[model samples]
Target chain A: MKVLVTVKEVAEVDDEFQISGLDVDDGSLEYDLNEWDDYAVEEAVQLSEADDDVEVVTVTIGPERAEETIRMALAKGADRAVRVWDDNLADAGFLDVDTKAALLAAVAEAEAPDIVFSGVQAGDDANGATGVALAERLGFEWAAVVNDFELDRDADVASVRRELEGGVEELTDVELPAVFTIQTGINEPRYASLRGIRQAQRKELEVRTIDDVGLDESVLESPVDRTDMYEPASEGDATYWEGSPEETAGELAAFLRDEGVVSS
Target chain B: MSVLAVAEHRRGEVRDVSYELVTAGRRLADGLGGELNLLVVGGDVDGFAEDLNRDGVDTVYTVDDGEEFNHGIHAAAIERLHADLEPTALVAPNSVDGLDYAPAVAQRLDVPLVTDVIDFEVDGGGIEVTREQYGGKVETTYQVDADQYAVTVRPAEWPQAEDRGDAAVEPIDVDVGGESGTTVNGFEEVGGGDVDITEADVLVSIGRGIEEAENLPLVEELADTLGATLSSSRPIVDNEWLPKNRQVGQSGKVVTPDVYIAIGISGAVQHVAGMKGADTIVAINTDPNAPIYDIADYGIVDDLFDVVPALIEEFGGDPPEV
Candidate 1:
């Protein structure tokens, strides 16, 4: 079984973001593989480790810096890497969703992977729309927020567990050649081993362009309006509740009741 | 030509967020110079749809089937409806179920999809949607360049319209026959003893500032006395002081109530993003400069220990002693 996983380079989750005076490209910030995409790569690697015939390939779209992200995935145990590099992609603004979807669709058509994996949502834009769109373009069945999965190559079916508001739903016997968007907490992602890092340095990575994949720039959707982007305003003064446990509890209860939070 | 809104229901009750989506859809439809039609899908959900017949909705399309909610089935039903009705726009609630099906429906129809839209308006030949990004530290606006667009309205962001009217209910015979790519084998409801925070009119959320897990009894006592549902930031849930079901943040639940009281919370962007939509926000952090205060309507610069008891005394409410 072959698996194709999509990874994205995004602003680091922990970095403090600052608006660069209305200039999108002028913004200087540290970057890393999107937090959720790490889970996608992790799931793909685990599937490969479980099956001898399974091969995991990672794909991303960005400038040359994005290669580092692909390298990180390769180190984590992807069999190979693909970078869809384009200089126009930097100022590309909002078109990444459609562009990436088109790229993934093209790749899937060429390789015909048995399964495709993506993060439930990207950490940077957090759109959570691309995976389903890509799946639809490729005409594959998809399950979103999937936490558990079991593949039956013989039966051509996959059983998956999806997370809901309060519980888990066990999805039984879904057809394969499908896409699954992995939610966080689905599995604990393993650290890249030293041996894996060395092997990643020697692995083959293929770079493809829009023209090479028979994709047109006309399909890209541009942002209609550029709204003012700003940091969210802060709120409140910190109030500390203190005293003996009994005293604090008594006081807190009274406060809630008085504030009309509780029925008095 | 008008917009179509999907109302979500379970067990004969309409979810609160469904009303919010209708309110937003009504506004968008009006802005587009079109009427709004509400669509409800579920078994025996006509009662739920009837209750949502407010001013903005021109008609209600009810598709009631005994089948449990399945993503593939729902998508197919919606695809058929979209082709038949030819709505200019489609709106869904950004709940777990809505997120599961909305994108698929949009994809099946080859339309653009936007999820978690906090604010939206109809632009020239497109829809502009503003959503929180980077864990709510920054807000980004997106415009879908498609003739027909679909969006999921974030819960609690828009006010639920209360225009009372008995809308004409149109029963649509949908062929619920489809190969379900997935089946629900079982379900386990979390926090059965506690009230759902999403339905709470008032919420008091705690953070790491609570100091210790043993001290949660203080917050719990307050919640008990006030009849307020207790919620917390992700860290508190991570620390096991509260159940994961009670965590309120970007990664957890987004809540909007009449009043939201932040007790001892430092207000990380993730936590603030969830409650910033409350009508009246009150912050009770010991640090006067905590981020939670920026959006708070009332700020207490003193220690919660000093202020909370004073507030109780002022209101003449007695606390329950353990």
Candidate 2:
């Protein structure tokens, strides 16, 4: 089995993002493989390890700097990497949801992986739509917010355990060539090794562009627009009730009732 | 100029978020000095449309197709509507389905797509949207630069509109061509047996401060007494003490209940980002300076072990057996 993992370079999750002073186009902030995507890549690596014939390929879209993110995946044990470079991609305002779906569709067309994996959502947008869209585009089965997975190639089915509203829901006998969008609690991602990092420098990386995938730039439409960016005003000082556990609970319940948040 | 709000439903029943989207659309339409039109699409959605029309919609377009939701069908339907109605803006809830389809519609229309909008207003000539960034640490406002804009309104951010006596219902025939490339072979519900936290008016969210899985029952007891639901921060879910659906954070479900009770949660920005919209927030933690208190309406600086049991007892709820 072969797996294709989609990764994106996003603003470092730990960075203090400033809306007023920063340029939206200029890549001024630190970048890393989306935190959730790392888990997807790790899942792919685990699959490959579980099956010797399994191959894991990592793919990402960004400028040349995005290669670093792909390299991080390689260092984490993906067999190879692909970097779809377009320096103006982000500035083109082409990062909307459908463009991403189309881009992944194009990648799926070229790679033909048996299984596709991605984090439920990206750190930048945190919309959690790509995997579902990609699955829809590829006409493959899909499950979202999955924490556990077991694939049976012979049966052409994948059993997934996903987090739903109340308890864990088990999806058994799902068809294969499916897409799974992993949730944050799926697994703890492993750190890259120094040896792996050194070897990643020599790993083969297949680079492609929008044209390479037969997608014309004209087909890309961005329905959303940004008029201006400004910082949100600070909320007023929060009220605090300090007391013994019993007293505090009593006061808190009373306050909730007073605020109409709870019925008396 | 008119605004079009997309209505989402399952099994011919409208989701609560649809009402919220309509309410948001009415506000934006009013701001733009236009009328609010609602677009309902689904299989056997006529009854759903009739139910939706009670909200006093100026125009209600119903597309009753027997097919379940597909991105291609939804996109094509939206595109067809855009061509005919020429709405100034299109709005939907920032839900899983909306995120999947809205971007496709935006890409098809060549317009800007603003998502996770907490607030929106029409300014001089464009739409201004406010959204949270950096996992809720910063709130950023954007002014859209497109003639036709698409936005996904965050749930709970806007109040549902009051139902009007009646509304004009129009049957809209949309040519949703054959499946674009995807088909819903089947639909399986996520975790079974758990209540939807989004629908819960009161949520008792536990954090690492709970210490052990056994202590969760104490929180559950309080929730039961208050007729509330039990939820958790990411760490509790990560530790497998609670299901992921109950996880409240950027990576989990975003809930804005009437009342939110946080026990032993240190309150990371990611977690706070998801729940800051709640009407009233109460935090109980040993640390007086926990970040959860920064946004909490009431703070209890005490050990949860002492607090939760007392809460259960005071509320006439059975305390968990130690």
Candidate 3:
């Protein structure tokens, strides 16, 4: 079965950003593949390496520079890469999850892979919506925040364990050709080897646009728009301790005991 | 116009975030000069919704489908109800379950979607949603058209709504095609070395204090005494004193434990970023000026070697023989 993995490139925003536009400040701003997407690429590549018939493909939606991220995935083991950059999308200024999902869905329709993988969320947008929305658009079964899963090739099914709040986890069985969002720490992402890196530069990288993908111009419109941004509110006023070690320990224990955090 | 909030529940009990949603939703609806309607789904949701109206909600819409947080059911049902009502805004939690289907519902309606919202405001003609990225290092606010939108609310933002007398309850059945796509086989609770720090309830996390790998047993003993999982800050993990999984920092795991005891940790910004969500923070440090104390609920200005023994003694927990 063919596995398609979705990746994203995000700006490593420094503390200083352009205040007038809430954009990254002009400096040594580094652009890298999203932190969470590393796990997705690793999972897909691991699946491909373990099976003889499985092939892994990586896709992203960004400017021309995003091909570096695709190459990063290829170095990890993705067979090929696809990048979608439409002039309309570029002109939209900002993008909401739906617009990104639309572009991703177009790529998925073009690839028509048997399964898809995406990072649980992006470090920049942190929307956590694209994978699920893309799945909905593709009419594929889906699971979110998955830490572990086993694809039953014979049964045409997958059993996935999802990470939930408060440390709870649930395992479910999903039919194949499904979308699974890979959570961070799900796997140890392998660093790109020298040989792998050299080979990735020679791999297939497909470039497409909205018109090329048969997507409508309306797909460029973001339902959610960013109007303004600023710093978050500061922390609450904290009471500091000025006592000796024993006194502070005693006081802290008492406080915690009263708070019911430490019953003893 | 009305604001629709998805009342999230697990098993048969309503998650506290549901009430928080109602509280936030009530304010949003009032700002728009509209009503607040909550959607409750599941098989025995009638019981969960019975007291849901005690708060700021104007109406609680119940769908007793007998399923517990099914992604397919909620997505399909939400899409159906959204199309039927055409509410001004739809809100759910930015949780595993909430994010699973909220986007699909929004996409199905072709409404603007936002996720992981920390806070929001109703502006002149639309709503401005604020969400933190880069681990709260940067905050971005988005403006969505007021006429239609769907978004997920982050947990623990607004206080749980208090009783506001009895509001009306409305039962609505929706026809969402069977399962959206998958079926649950079962769940496996963490019991062993899977030791996902993110899943621990109480974490006895150490840092540079233990000093040497030989001193680990001290913290391990204390962890056993408190029945807490053992973890540490990035320094220990970087030094290979602890595994990466045991590290609690930005590059490590983001944990929201009920109680986090930082032993000898200085609380760097990146380190504090991962533990900021903890319900209660206890920092034990020799330096009173440590940054951890700023966010810690309780601070003990003491050396870990001196204070940990006292703590173990106070709890009457026997430390393993050194």
Candidate 4:
């Protein structure tokens, strides 16, 4: 069995930053492996470790800078990596959900993995749609926000617990050849070991363009255009407690007391 | 041209977002000078359709299907409905269940999809959606340059339409029981542990700002000093530094404590959803522009390491050394 984990290198903005135009300034943006994908990678790796002949491959749609982030996944446990990037994708103003799914669908078709895992959502775009959309494109079954699951190889079913809103977990069984969007808290993602890091340097990190992935530049054509970006106007009517930490603490203490929730 | 919004439900009751979707769909339909249609599938469709007949709703389409939400069934039903109606806009919730099927519907329909939309406008030829990115640090507007598109509205962004209207209730029986690849066994209630954060009057919620598990004692002492319960944002629970029961977020518990003190938390939209109803909110963080301050009644823009300890001292409790 093979598991393909889709990972993304998401951009996290600095505490104080500048929006140059349609995006935050490059100096203000820091890229890291998406938080949710870390869990997905761990889930795939754990599956590979427990079972024989389970090859874990990582796939990402990012530029060259993201290879560093992809390596983090490889250093943990993925057997190899595939990265799809081209000049067209970088120039593409905004990639909407459809465009992303189409690009990923092309790769999944070629790989033909038994199972696909994607983060529930990226920390940056937070569309939370790519995985299921890709499943739709591939004609595969899917489950979203999956926090726990047990795969039955003989029956070709996965008994999963999907974390719903407000403390509810929906228990579901999805057939094989499926996509499961891994949610946070599903498992503890391990830190890359020193030995694994050295091995990752020698692993196959194949880079592909749109053409290489059997996709044309037309795949980059998106109907969505990012028009404007700005800091949201502060809705805070919060009274600032200005002073040293001690003085602000005193003000908070007094306020808590005044509210009668706390007593001095 | 009309606008269609899918009503969401779980277990036996309709979700609040279903009504909010009506309110959102009404706005889009009004902008396009068209009709507003609501779609309810599975689990008390008739009752859901009746409750969804808001003041501005023009029609309610019910598909009597399974007892609970099945994404495969939903995707098939919605795809057929979209084809038959050809609505200008397909609006659904950005909730967990919505994510399960909305993307599939959009993909099958080959229409552009924008999720977690906070605000939108239909003008001239296209729709413009406003959504937050980079963890609510900034808002970006996207122009969907298409006549037909799909969007999932963020919960609680729009007020629910309460005034009842006599919308035409049409039951559309689409064949959706062909082959569902997934089966929902049942639902289990998680996060039931020792302390129920929902019952607390005061909550001192620590987030990623607590730094490490060892530093948790610092905030625990603060919660102890003020006779408050200790709760946390999702990261604390994800890290296993705190129990799942102590998590305050959309997935965990909706806490309406008298006072919610957010420490070192940037206040993601999900986290804010759980505690925004607090009578008084206080935020302590180093970042002056954290989203938590936007909703807080009082704020201290300082390092939590310094302010938390001082606050503990102000309450006449010795701060624990991390």
Candidate 5:
């Protein structure tokens, strides 16, 4: 069986940052593997480790700079990697859900993996829609916010637990040829060891353009356009305690005592 | 140019987002000069439809299906409803199940989808959605230039519709029984442990700012000094530094303590959802722009490492050496 994991390298903005046109200034941004996708990669890799004939392949839609993030996934245990990017995409200011699902659908059609894994949402956009949209495009089954699962190879079913709000988990069983959007805290994602990191350098990392993935510039067309980006005007009316640590702490202590929730 | 809003339910009760979708749908419908139609797919459809008929709703459509949410059934039912109604826009909750089916429905209909929209406006037959990015540090607006679109509104952003309306309750038969790719077995309530943080009057919560598992003692000492229960944001529980029972967020326990002292917590939307009801909220963090400040009644903008020790000293307690 083959598993395809969708990985993304998302940008984390600094506490104090500047906005440059449509996005955060490059100088104030830090790039890393998405926290949620890390869990998805580990889920796929663990599946590969538990079974005899399971093969893990990761697919990413990012620029060449994302190779570092892709390599991190490879080091964690993915057998190989496929990256889809080109100039047309780099110029596309905002890629909406349809555009992204179409791009991923093109790759999924070519690879045709038995199972697909993606993060519940990206840390940046947080759309939380691409995987289910991709599944719909491929006519495959899907489950979202899946935190735990037991895959039955023989029956070709995955008994999964979808984490809901307020500490409730819905149990469900999805048929094979399905997509599972893995949630965080599902499993402990292991760190890439020294040997794994060295081995990742030699792993096959294939780069393909939009056309190479059997698509053209038309895939970049979307109805959604990002108009503006800015730090939201602060709605805070908080009474700030401004002083040295001792003075501010004293203020908080006095307030807590006045409220009778704390005693000194 | 009507708006269709779908309601969600679990077990036997309709979720709060269902009512919130009504508020969003009514706003868009008013802007577009059309009607606002509501939908309840499964699990007590009649009852849910009655509850969802808010002041501005014109029609409530109910499709009686299973007792629980199965994405396969939900996706099929919603797609069929959209095709029949042909509304100018479709609105759903950005809940876990909403993420499951809204995207699939939008994909099948080939409409532009914008998820987790905190605010939106309809103008000249087009829509612009406002959403947060970089973990709510910044907000971005996007214009969707389409005749029809789908959007999921973030939960708790809009107030729940409480006033009942005089809308026509209609039962619509949607054929979703043949949809069998997935089956929802049942639901399980997790996070049962030694401590029930919900019962506490005071909660000292830590977040990613705590830095490492070894540094947890710093916050433990503060909680002890205040004689408060210990809780945390999702990351601390995700990191396994604390047990799942101690987690305070959307997926964790909803805590309404008398005093919620948030140390080093950035107050992500999920984290805020769990603790925003506290009577008094105090934040201690170095970042002045953290979302936690928006809801905080009192705040100290300083490194937690410095302020925590001082707070312990003010309470006449020795800070633990981490």
Candidate 6:
């Protein structure tokens, strides 16, 4: 089974972030591999380690700077990396998620992997649309927000559990060749071993342009318009209770009871 | 012209957010000078379909095929429904199931899809939706350039639509089968078997200030006395003091209870992202400078050790069930 994992690099903003036009201020922002995609790469590497025949491949769609992120995935054990970039996409600065999914699906079609794994959503957009949409565009079965996953390689079926609202879970058997969007805590992502990092420097990392992926310029057009972005309205107008801990607790209970949250 | 609201139901009951979607749908439909129509997809869901027939919707379309939410069936059913109705807008919950299928339906129809919409409006014969960005730190409003769209509304943003007698239910039969070819086996419960805090009206949540694993029962006593569920921040769950299911944060679960009593939680952005929707927030922290104070309606700048016991006593001296 050939396993393909999709990874993205996102900004890590610890301090206040400023919106500069259609994007955030990248001055203090440090771009690293997305937290969720790290888990996807780790899952693929672990699956490949279990069986020597399972070849692990990593793919991404970003600027040339993202190749460093691809290397990070390879250092954790992916056999190879593929990056998709185009002047049309970079010139637009931001591409609609649909176009990105279309381009990624095209890449997936070219690879034709038996199983694909993508982070449920990227931190930058947090739209959570790309993976499932790519699956649809590629005609692959999909499961989203998966937590506990088990694969029966012989049956080409995966018996997995998905995280749902109110802590409810759904267990399903997905027939491969399928796409699975991974949730956090599904696995503890492994770090790059010293030896693996050395091998990653020598690993195959290929780049493909939009023309190479068989997608046209029409799909690359920006569809959504960002009219404005600003800090969320400040909400700190709170009344601090100043009294003994006992008195404060009693008052708090009374307040909540009045709010009809606690029955008195 | 009409806006289609997709009602979500599970375990034979329609969710509260489904009604909220109707309320949101009504606003958009009114703006578009159209009516609101509801669509429910599931098997043995005649009751849920009837229950979804509220006053706001012009018609309730029920597609009885899958027992639970199957992504393929939802996409195919919505596609077929859109083909016939051609509603100007489609509204659904920005939920796990909705996120999985809404974009697919949007893709099939070749329309722009937007998720996690906190506010929306029909402006000058076009659509404008506002959603959070960078983990709710920023809210961006966009002008969606599309004649029709699939929008997933964030929960707890609007009040639930009041039921003013049931509307006429128009159950429609359509093939749930689609070319995507995915199957539903079954759903089982995972994580620690605890009361789902997401469903609770009141939640007593703790954080690193709870200090140690041994003192968890103190919070439990407060929760039990108030008839609230016991929940915690990621630190407590990371320390294994509580199960992952009860952890409230971006990585954990999103919950919007009526009252969230945050004890000893500093209110990190990630944690706040999950529970920011609570109607009233009462935070107990030793530091008045805690970030939790920003969003909190009330705050007690005192030690939780003293306050929790008094709160538990205020609810009367009933021993904690735990």
Best first by lDDT, ranked: 4, 5, 6, 3, 2, 1
What local distance difference test score does each model get? 0.73, 0.74, 0.79, 0.93, 0.92, 0.82
- Runs in model 6 with CA error above 4 Å? A239-264, B178-180, B193-230, B234-241, B249-294, B298-322
Between candidates 3 and 5, name the one with more favorable DockQ.
5
Better of 2 and 3 by lDDT: 3
Clashes of each: 18, 16, 1, 0, 0, 0
Stretches of candidate 5 off by over 4 Å are B177-179
DockQ, cand. 6: 0.47
User: lDDT by residue for model 1 over B217-247, one digit each (tens)?
Assistant: 6667655545678898866765567777787
Candidate 3: docking tier: acceptable
Candidate 6 has a TM-score of 0.83
Each candidate's TM vs. the true structure? 0.78, 0.72, 0.80, 0.99, 0.98, 0.83
Best by lDDT: 4
Better candidate number, 2 or 6, judged by lDDT? 6
lDDT of 6 by residue, B1-322 (tens): 6899898988878988899988899999999999888889986667887677777878888888868898888887888889898998989888888887887788788888887898987887569889877656567888887778778898777889877745677777877654445666676554556457789889999998989888888888778778889999876875567887898976577889988989999886568868999988989998665668889999999998888887888878544432
How big an interface RMSD has model 3? 6.5
User: What is the Cα-based TM-score of model 2?
Assistant: 0.72
Give lDDT: candidate 2, residue A237. Answer: 59
lDDT of 2 by residue, A140-221 (tens): 7676667777887887777766544223243434577888888666776789999989998999998877778778675355
Residue range B1-322, candidate 5, lDDT tens digits: 9998988888889898888888888888988999999888878888888777789999998888888887777777778888888999999999999999999999888899999999998878699999999999999999999999999999999988889899999888877757588988898999998999999999999999999999999889989999999999988888888999999989999999999999999999999999999988999988888999999999999999999999999989999887
Q: Sorted on TM-score, highest at the top, how do the candidates line up?
A: 4, 5, 6, 3, 1, 2
lDDT for each residue of candidate 4 in B205-255, tens digit (9 for 90 to 100):
999998899999999999999999999999999999998999999999999
Off by over 4 Å in 2: A12-20, A23-32, A50-53, A62-69, A84-115, A129-180, A186-202, A205-231, A241-264, B67-73, B179-204, B208-231, B243-280, B284-295, B299-322
Which residue ranges in model 4 land beyond 4 Å of their true spot? none
For A1-264, candidate 5 gives per-residue lDDT tens digits of: 999999999999888899999999999999999999999999999999999799999999999999999999999999999999988888886788888888889888999999999999999989999999999999999999999979999999999999999999999999989999999989999999899999999999998999999988988888899999999998888999999999999999999999998766
Candidate 2 chain B: 10-residue stretch with minimal lDDT: B179-188
Pairs in clash, predicted candidate 5: none
Q: Which stretches of candidate 3 lie over 4 Å from their true place?
A: A15-20, A26-28, A86-88, A236-264, B178-180, B191-229, B232-294, B297-322
- DockQ of the candidate models in sequence: 0.29, 0.27, 0.40, 0.91, 0.89, 0.47
